[model samples]
Target: MAKPVADTFSPSENAAGYVSDDNPVLGFSHMHDSGTGGLPSLGNFPLFVHPGCPGDDFTRCAYSLTFRTTSRVPGSVTAAPGYFAVNLTNSVRAEMTATQHAVLYRFGFSGDEHVDVLRDLKRPDEVEKGVPYSPLVLVDLVDLMNSRSLGGILVSPETGRVMGEGRYLPSFGSGKYDAFFCADFKGAAIRKTGTFVGNDAAENPKILDGVGSGFHIPGGSAGAWLQFERPTNNSLLARVGVSFISIEQACENAEKEIADWHFERVESDARKQWREKLGVIEVDPTGVSEELQTTFWSGLYRTLLSPQNYTGENPLWNSTEPYFDSFYCIWDSFRAQHPLLTIIDPIAQTDMVRALLDIYRHEGKLPDCRMAFCKGFTQGGSNADVVIVDTFVKKLTAGIDWDTAYEAVVSDAEVEPPNWGLEGRGNLVSWHSLGYIPWDDTDLNGTGPMSRTISRGVEYAYEDFCIATLAEALGHAEDAAKYRRRGGNWRNYWNSDQRDVFQDPNDVTVQTDYTGFMQPRLVNGTFRYHNTRACSPVQEMHRCYYDTHLDTYEGSPWLYSFYVPQDMATLIQLMGGPAAFVDRLRFFHTSGIAYMGNEQGFLPVFQFHYAGRPGLSAYFVREYIPALFNASVNGIPGNDDCAMGAFSAFAMMGFFPVAGQDVYLLSTPFFPEVRIRARTEGKWSVIKVWGFDPEGKKKYIQRAKLNGRMYTKNWITHDFFLKGGTLELWVGEEEGTWGTKEADLPPSWPVEWADGGGVGLDDKF
Candidate 1:
């Protein structure tokens, strides 16, 4: 799918795709991946527009990307569901919208009698003063990171159609991909066409091809331009068709999708598509502030922006399966984004699952992260397993090949790829034999970042648990039992004597009563000492990342210690039963150790339900909703990765999903009523609140009912949404005993297995 976006030039190297404010407009490109981390991606073939050059000299127009940059007018940028518009200081206003594979842009000219050439040059001295209104647009054969290795551009003399293709590196993945675009213009007669290299322009030879000596162009700019005569209406429309296949298909896509070149119609159609997608979930915003409402709806909007539908654009292989790209790293999205999609848009989710299976069919492994037809780094476990199983458990089986899906996940659990850093799991031998990813792991079977032992161990266990769920559902009982036992490997990293302590910004040491944390262990069975709060917000915050030597990934042991979602019954007991578990979780959230920016922190907010205190879960949900998440310009706490929006949507809707499971932990919704129309049955599942508080004071559920029957458990399943029913909750200011009983806790594995020990079935909670 096309995500035509403005590539703003920012000093921040990790400003992926786009930035909202405090950056100059680079150019409007036809493709981009939003909400991803690391260097910018796929801002290829950016089209920069110039109203006119001084003295009508075509060479006077800026040709290089750095020279062509212009500041955006302050307070003039507006973005909606499907349309984005901005005013440049150069006196040209640009607005754009898109279809599946093409972008339509409407550029409005100032129509001033006099052109500002000195100002365009950023020089004080005035040279040639005035010229009649005209326009010059150029398509640069370069990407956001200047990562073009080889590219070519051609402009048609008769039609002024600009077609180009570039081979560039993916933002966070291995290998390179080729992107193609076909740009067409309307509303003006073609004055001239030419190709440019660096600052030099020529009128002859409409094509320019360059092969870079390295990943980037050897020196300067290379592109094609189409100069236009002054239009009667002083406006121009540009339609760009993009593809991962070929330029001919790109042109065909443009002509088929936007042949009429009607800007308003395209924009309207895009808005309608977005509305249909977002209209599935309806919330009563009568009592909510506009800010909170914006937060809620915008979060829903962001969730649909990624894992884009690239059904027919894939060029890797000829297949009939739907090809959805830009997984943009599922490590961040598997927790909430995909689960939310299963409820609101099962058709798209089913297509995405089929896409994953197709990728496995061709590549021999499920990618943990993928974009632009390239394999991205595996941050931890094979998390696509979580996504596939989540859909399976939710019964999104419209067109999914469940047999192939099962084989895909089993391969992730059993096989090791050649370069596990890029795809599949590494150290599977150690994971199975040692029951943990040892800190000093010797992964001779494959290679990857040897650290994140404790983090990867816990994640791999949960991933296997997800696969076990599917195996059991498919009657593979032996496989189910084996993976169910492997799910307890998280217990191997639990070091009981590790104490919690933190040194604050003021150099003051703060010690806590909490003991026991997920620590790194050597192959010899000796626990390695890792600070309990090493990568927390209060401590070495940047120490744990993709390449860190730390035992955790983007979080501290204090946070990952609460990650045994497969069997919280055992985890609660290990932390000294439900009450003690609540105390420690509260400390983790309040003691500045938990950072909501990362996806790992999302589940712990609702984990209180597993401790038999669903009211406390509601309390924490409120604490983070308007505090860390709001509608301000800098609304989200950190990198979105689409999961931030999914987290907000799930939180405001009064429930949270444990990914790859059939459960949805219930809490107090920000709205008085929420209605979700199921995609399969065409019926609505409504959650209505009685005694609702607009001020968010009454948050504890006193009691609940499903379809007029009394309901006590704090969690619901996918059946509630599929079958269409009404869930009613009566809430109060006081902590309620409604969901506090041991029997009301969310489901978890009943048996507990120690490291290298046989499983023991314990019914006690």
Candidate 2:
């Protein structure tokens, strides 16, 4: 059985590094997911050192015994930005730090005897008793994360360089791909080296290739080993670089990034890079606990994990355009993650937009949830369109080919790929024909696999709005009118007859009513009942219903009921005006239906401002920071999903971006002062925020001032942010009616779609 380890709160297998406060020391594995849940990929190689080996040479070394120590090590593992260290139970101290594409590791041994280095490419679950750890270095080419190996090779052992390449499939709808690696042994010389096929050393084999055959178990485990000479300091440092292209490229990456491995220089440079990335927004950490400050930085750190930079790593074709993969999924990111990037790093955002466009040109569609060079199951809609539009609309589309980019968006909106659900808009035909997606197939016994038709209907509506905005920007008025009209199709799912009635438990006299909830309906207009707390007459409607119980994606119908961001005015009116909407918001919060952990309810926190209750928005957002989040390993409630990290970053900075729009909702910041370095006129400009009484109980914003004048509303425009200015907010102990007036509320665009040159298309573009 596999050894017991502490729960590291990591759900994805491709996690970069894994740790738990009290867990036993599992050998540090390379390549890990930040925060995800699925059959993970990329725990590709784990390195460990074993003492008291049976053989002195690689050929006679035992290959098949477990290397993990039986007992757990206490208080051993420590992790920081670009660094991780652990002292194993076996008295081997290992420390690791990373660069952009490579990692440098140092292993220190306590015993004076010669030791063996073990490289296990086996899946975590596949580790078995009596499995050989022989051979200096083993390369298992067959077993990968939900992948079958096509081919692999380990070159003849050289003094300081060890190189290998394997072609295998990645996880979850990903295509087959190649992984090439090159490692540099800094202080060790190769004394022995050998290759193995299915657990036995290959006899007189100069080159090992082809599918596994003639082994005890065909295509079982194949690898190469290199035993190194003992070092003077009882330590060994290795630098490894990996690429999907070629071994030469891997070596180049290491040479360019890590160069000569002065472990401290690489480690310091890695930490410095992280500091520079997080340094975009400077915060005065005074008054907040160190833990809270760490939480903010860690959240920012998690945001950069995926949509990995694959610039020169695209295996299919060579292109100068920036290429990125491991989108993991864009639906989880387009909301806050990409928007946050627009504010902090416009250059990175522009490159990301270009990368998405490049993918469209090469693969014939924008990547939805891409991994391993292939499109996987799409979560909701073509959210990459939303991401591109969000950046494009913010005027961040400079230097990008706008015409070609717009064509890609139109292709996704209009064309249907063969596997519509995974890559392109399969349901667009139904959506275009019917105002909303009419449930023509589902609604039987709820066994429709991959069915989230109602959820998709709402997502499609928002996506249409995104396209409409792009259309308006590009002077395509007719296209804008058509898509803008379709954007409001979210109303079709709003069943006015369905009411969320709240009554006083002790006294039946007091009660409240909230109407116009999202209901599942069929093509024939028959309402489908969900087995939920709210829908079940026998069950007390206290806890929120899971999304799966209703015909929604990742959130319940009640949560989906508030999913309308493009037309919040209509949503407010649909919920029975501002007072009624605020009351319903309170009900959702008090009834445990408001899941603050996910993207579904992310925007609702800002909707309070739309209700002319900016102080309440500030209050709730402020309290939520320290309450729902922390600085520990389990700080995030669920999958970072990139969205949560972005949200947390925004929350710390005292503002939230209205996705796809230039507007930002205001809130009281956790810090006393914040500054953002804005890029303007080919230089960095300063955007400063000063809050009076930031650390005290007087945490409510009484009023805000822009420049030297009093700002009426509770928000700022992206143009103002880019131009740079001073924003000052006065705080007090009690809530003040600063942004409570209806006229002071943020602008809510009308849902009506006006055709025939309403936006002056002839003059704009």
RMSD per prediction, one decimal?
A: 2.6, 6.7
Off by over 4 Å in 1: 13-16, 117-132, 211-220, 505-510, 680-682, 756-765
Q: Could you tell me every candidate's TM-score relative to the true structure?
A: 0.96, 0.86
Q: CA shift at 138, candidate 2, in angstroms? A: 4.7
Off by over 4 Å in 2: 1-30, 52-72, 114-148, 158-160, 197-207, 211-221, 441-450, 501-512, 531-550, 681-696, 753-765
| RMSD (CA, angstroms), candidate 2 | 6.7
Give per-residue CA lDDT, model 1, range 1-765, as digits (tens): 887767787778534555886567878987877788888888888888888876688887888876777777778889897799988767788999998899999999877766653323244363345654679998888788888888888999998899988889988889999999999999899998998876677887798776454434333468898889886698999999998899999999999999888888998999999999998999898878999999999999999988988888888999999998888779999999999999988888888999999999999999999988999999989999999999988988888888998999999999999899998888899888978887787888888888888888899999999999999999999999999998988887877667786666788887778977888888787888899988888788999888999889999999999999899998888788888999999988898889999999999999999988999999999999899899997799878888899999999999999999999999999999999996546789999999999889999999999999999999999998898999999999999889888888899895456554212213233
Q: For model 2, how does the per-residue alpha-carbon lDDT over 645-689 read when each residue is reduced to its tens digit?
A: 888888878788878776788887777787777756433323334
lDDT of 2 at 167: 62
Backbone N/Cα/C clashes per model: 0, 16
Q: Which one is best on TM-score?
A: 1
Report the lDDT of model 2 for residue 381: 74
